[model samples]
Target: MYALENEGGIKKVKKLDQFLQDNLNDLRDRGLYNEIDPVEGPNGPVIKISGKELINLSSNNYLGLATNDHLKEIAKHAIDQYGVGAGAVRTINGTMDLHVKLEEKLAEFKGTEAAIAYQSGFNCNMAAISGVMDKNDAILSDELNHASIIDGIRLSKAKVIRYNHSDMDDLRAKAKEAAESGLYNKVMVITDGVFSMDGDLAELPEIVEIAKEFNLITYVDDAHGSGVMGKGAGTVKHFGLSKEIDFQIGTLSKAIGVVGGYVAGSKDLIDWLKVRSRPFLFSTALPPGDTAAITAAVQMIMDSTELHDQLWENGRYLKEGLLKLGFDIGKSETPITPCIIGEEKLTQQFSKRLREEGVYAKSIVFPTVPQGTGRVRNMPMATHTKEMLDQALAVYEKVGKELSIIN
Candidate 1:
């Protein structure tokens, strides 16, 4: 506990500012402090940061729909009809017709019996995980699961058994131990359908098989997989195991090009979340424009795979270009490319050099990934033209040679 002397003779805990300054200084000294760069305009294939235009590669806008003309129009129309905000929390007066419709479309899109939406993807994890699992339960979570999932499990107060990343054997061993331990009331296995940092797909088929063997509850957060896999449905649909998984989690902000998160699952599960999830019950509903745009985005994805295909094409082009330049592009099953640079400060320097040379891929370091595996993560969007990718590649080559990261 930190305390400071008050103006009078009283002792007070007024060292918060000192604490923050010390921690911030430590991060800066260690090269772990992240500096936020504000984009000057719309976040698209090309972005203006500090008045300089660069090929944007740090965004999660996989489909490039965030700045789509049609979606923008729909969002404007929604604002006209319903104003900017959802007046109250869902349990109060906030459950608008658009909310109902969006949930319906989400259920249809995810191939689930029902769905519930939350304010954000992070909140969905916080709400859903704690809503279902309690202290008596045990969760066998993938070691590389998203930070949101980790925090959600912590909130649940469940016994968290971390399985090695994408290791089915480890998962099975842990699942069996937890399920037959006779201490837990229930056992659950949760994983990200697509690990965001490394861009690897989870082995859902094996996980589903193991879950069935032990009657484990299965949860897949497909925030990155949805709209990019399974003809734009999700990873669950990709593996043809929609009916087998217990929770199908996704976000509207990423490929969907809007804002919000949802859990699509059995009707009972959704119903339970609606009432039990703290965020859904306590926070205001998603605003009207975002909800409408999200619905439109899902419809566009279901209507065609044009954007999805283009995204993959750009991803492959960028990946090939980086690999050809002798950069250590990791084995990414998706478009999320990581140009591996070994040290944290050097990785940050590499990213800084890339930006200076007109690319905007961000460096991801320790705490986001393990130490010594720092890299610049590139997210190629659907709208990135061939010329844009070539330019980015040229910049990468120059920076790589300058840093002696490649031959």
Candidate 2:
């Protein structure tokens, strides 16, 4: 083993150590460096971070339900009945009745034949994509699919063909080529219902039409679209094409304000995942408290669109205010708005300035997005008041002017 103080009589570190240093250096050079700040309070539109109260614009708690009283009460009751941990994988002794109840609730919420739960939205991608496709199959994936989906596809041992983001012509060409090659046993076309980076929606209806033409198995990762779109169900419901899309993947972590993932599809697909998906088989099921909380969240989403409506109202108000303030709110239709800042350094500076002004917007730089496309990603929660939005807009205006990002 190499000694820390001296290695081969040299004071320098090894090549492996250089790798991390080099990567971090590159990040710093490009102004993409990230720093973790401790959140001192609950997750809401406004939170106390490092003792400063800032309007939180970086969280995925879309409906502000993460800290809801009702959900908390349900979780506490479940903990009393079922304890804290699952203790084993679902296939072993971890599958509780609560798990079944949540899965059933999800199916009802998604209006699908069946649904199976995983530990996260990321896990859902890994489990579903890898479970379905193998080395002999080919996957037609959107260029901007989530990192989890990319890793999942890599694990599948499938030939991945990247299509231009939401380009139906490109998707059709790739799908046709894959199908005509006949070298693969299955063809799966996957896309995100809402691109997280840009917030522009996927052309699902057109993609579905192309899927029909190419006999491709369709997959929609609605991680950012669910609960906000589809009338609080999902993008599939938004497009009125739920029956046409084969696999519907969503996150409970985001809109549901809980921790887990699920796949809504045909009963056969759910059955196959329950049996073969590595995450499903290897990981402990969600705890009873999370399961019960998730069930309440889903039922709340299904029964009333209050949260969804409020979220949209907040989104619109924020976007309009930013635009009026001469800030470039990018091509976003959903609550996931990004105020585009040209250079990565300035973007980071802008975010820092916003934080100093009591607004907790985070800067996203290259690698997470393309260079020269850095942004301050703001997700306005349903619980945000008009007063809060107005205050955030004022901060953005001040920061924008200070940085010369706006006149």
All candidates' TM-scores? Answer: 0.97, 0.97
Clashing pairs in 2: none
TM-score of candidate 1 versus the correct structure, residues matched by position: 0.97
Each prediction's total of clashing residue pairs, residues at least 3 apart in sequence or on different chains, is 0, 0
> Please, what are the lDDT tens digits per residue for candidate 1 over residues 1-407?
46777689787766787778789998777778898999999999999999999999999999988999999999999999999999999999999999999999999999999999999999989999999999999999999999999999999999999999999999998888888889999999999999999898999999999999999999999999999989899889999999999999999999998888999999999999988999999999999999999999999999999999999999999989988899887779999999999898999999999999899999889889998999999999999999999999999988899989998
The residue-by-residue lDDT of candidate 2 on 1-407, one tens digit each, is 23255656666667787888889898888788898889997989889988889888899999978999999999999999999988899998999999888889888888899999999999999999999999999999998888999999999999999998878888898899999987999999999999998788999889988889889999999999889898899888999998998999999999999999999999999999999999999988898899999999999999999999999999999988988888888788788899999799999999999999999998998778888999999999999999999999999888889889999
lDDT of each: 0.94, 0.91
Those runs of model 2 whose alpha carbons end farther than 4 Å from true positions after fitting are 1-12
